[model samples]
Target chain A: MTTTPAADTAVTAAALALGDDALVLSHRLGEWAGHAPVLEEEVALANIALDLLGQARVLLSMAGDEDELAFLREERAFRNLQLVEQPNGDFAHTIARQLYFSVYQHLLHDRLASGDGPFAPLAGKAVKEAAYHRDHAEQWTLRLGDGTDESHARMQAAVDALWRYTGEMFQPVEGIDGVDWPGLESTWRDIVEDVLGRATLTLPEGPRTGAWRAGAGRQGLHTEPFGRMLAEMQHLHRSHPGATW
Target chain B: MVTTTPLEEQLLELAGSVPDPELPVLTLRELGVVRAVRAHGTDSVEVDLTPTYTGCPAVEVMSLDIERVLREHGVREVTVRRVLAPAWSTDDITDEGRRKLREFGIAPPRTGAASGPVRVALGPTRTREGGPADEPEPVRCPHCGSPETELLSRFSSTACKALRRCLACREPFDHFKEL
Candidate 1:
């Protein structure tokens, strides 16, 4: 009853792509639980992660069992961007990653929400939460980038280091609402530039295009870090297969 | 404002009054997220509820709680469905809900004007006093009933709150964010 055959398949593919993005990033943020720099940030990051997890639950459940989709999927089956699966290098790196992903998520959700597509209800709902996620990232980016010398250096390094992975987010996913990716990219660039400039940081010079630009996570391919991360994420659910809490 | 049959009225009096899992102070009815509670065929009842936020984790729990509560009261069949067409808004929180939220130590949703940071279906993100010149004043502290409070952070312990510290009471309170 959820859909016709063709629509279901298309929706499933689109959901998995977007859902994996949120699920993987949620797990990555969950990794910060006991390790974030401060107690407040521990709560804040967890809030954002939980929000993503909730979105992931709805999106993944649209295709199949959320628990199975999240816990049982092999690393290569994941369609998340390589950027999200990257390790939390440091607090600054984490914030930088959040900044990139949340803005894209916000804009993407906004576009989807404006349409009558199947993803609209969820996306319309999700974009608001993504706004907060972006705000959280922006707040810290500004504070860290313009703060003490150590903080500024770390923030700058994090931004520059993660620039390459961002390109994968813009790759067209089949069945997602037809969005103007070129326009989205430009908007993202403008927003990031404004925020980073105000924070006294420069735009990352790393390649985001051409043959050398890092990407390809969309085709169920991922980097080395993802394998390890996925293993850890799946361990608990795998430990007691078929057990329910 | 709710129009229902006598049987539905009986069901709603119980089913609609379920407290929100996150706020706990406001009922689903008072919060206005309970869209409907009526008969769903011969011997079954259905409750329609929407989440405060699309991603609020409490929505599922709230649904489960509603089912549990109704079944415990001898309702043979119950179904909880979530709808998204007419999306939920902070404006839907009733005045009674706001009063209850204050008693529960969380500042209620802003009464009028978009002063708090809330997102909706359309338009650019217009944040509070930062841009909107006609936006209302800051939410008052719930503790001392004072107008003097400093916002500690827009993101708080929960998605629907902003952390505010009262200048009068020196107490950190949760302001139910507009959204």
Candidate 2:
């Protein structure tokens, strides 16, 4: 059961990518802690955020010190998905981001969990939690998509706004296997389409590939919003280093 | 590694009885998180535990509680180790623990089903002996004996339970999610 050095390095990098995604999104969701439109949603979002945070802890710890990786890393050094670091524009926008990401996450975890990959244990444990996360997002998508004209429009626009970020998720990450990206992408689209249809919203007619694809979070080139978000996230930790709570 | 002592064994019993922070009705022993309590020499104690869920925040509190309880009992030093190798599952919850959950207004984890995807229902009493039934037997209401129930949410106040509403009692209760 020896892993080649190249393979080991690849798995570590992939883990870093996935870890960053969870860490960033967890922070974004945590921002909605008190400001959620409803009380139940606040708890729900927090629960999801905590779940992702737990995952980030495990994943980042695999690469290096979890605290250092999460708090000390520079903005250009982060490898999180751009979609996750995107602002929680509104409740509708947050849900839209959640729907796309959770679906991808669930499928990715499922694939990993079903195999003998380096991440099998974590994936096996996380897949169930991710299932609930996906369900939570799906249920909300259905509710908000079908709730009212105003709600529907907002949700639809959110889906449209975040569509570009979806392309980067399926990019072939080295040292990772067992994930069928095309199949995963199709499944993601199918599920999103079903939810959008049930909500009576149309898919945004935009390019998700070629010249219009939005990505490079894997390469540590994030969108403009990420720098400010990273500063805010690391502020308290950076402010009081070596001070035990 | 130190051998067990009489007083250290007593401390194990007390530590095992420490109630889970979230599910107060169940003890750490009943929940099966207390894997071992070894005596690290005469004055020190070490207790091993596993979390119900990998990311459950309560695990830290549970560790601190174990230490606090043991120290309060005049044990000089306490160490709580979190082990993650074999991993924890719902099946780890003992029969006493399951019964306690039900008695505490929470539905217990239903047995006689595969660990795969399940269709949670409040319908009829279907079982493995019932032969090739695709669906699980309904989660009976913890408040009332009614099988008429609805899954309100896949999550509840915590990760281990789903929010359920009983049509008979019109009360929303937690159903320990089968992990």
| Candidate 1 backbone overlaps, count | 0
Q: Per-prediction TM-score, please?
A: 0.91, 0.84
Candidate 1 per-residue C-alpha lDDT over A1-245 given as tens digits, one digit per residue, 9 for 90 to 100: 46688877888989998999999999999999899887778878888898898889889988899988899988878888888999999899999999999999999988988888988988867877888788889888989999999999999999998998888777788777679988998999999999999999999985774354444787887878999998898898899898776
Compute the lDDT of residue A194 as modeled in candidate 1: 91
Candidate 1: the clashing residue pairs are none
lDDT tens digits, residues A140-227, model 2? 7878889888888898889999887888888877668878888988988888898788878787667664353445888888888999
Summarize candidate 2's per-residue lDDT along B1-179 as a digit string, tens digits.
Answer: 66667876787789989999998999998888888788866678888887777779999999999999988988789889876544566777889998899899998877644266522222232222343466566787888767777777666698677777887888988888776
lDDT of the structure predicted as candidate 2:
0.81
DockQ of each: 0.39, 0.31
Best candidate, lDDT: 1
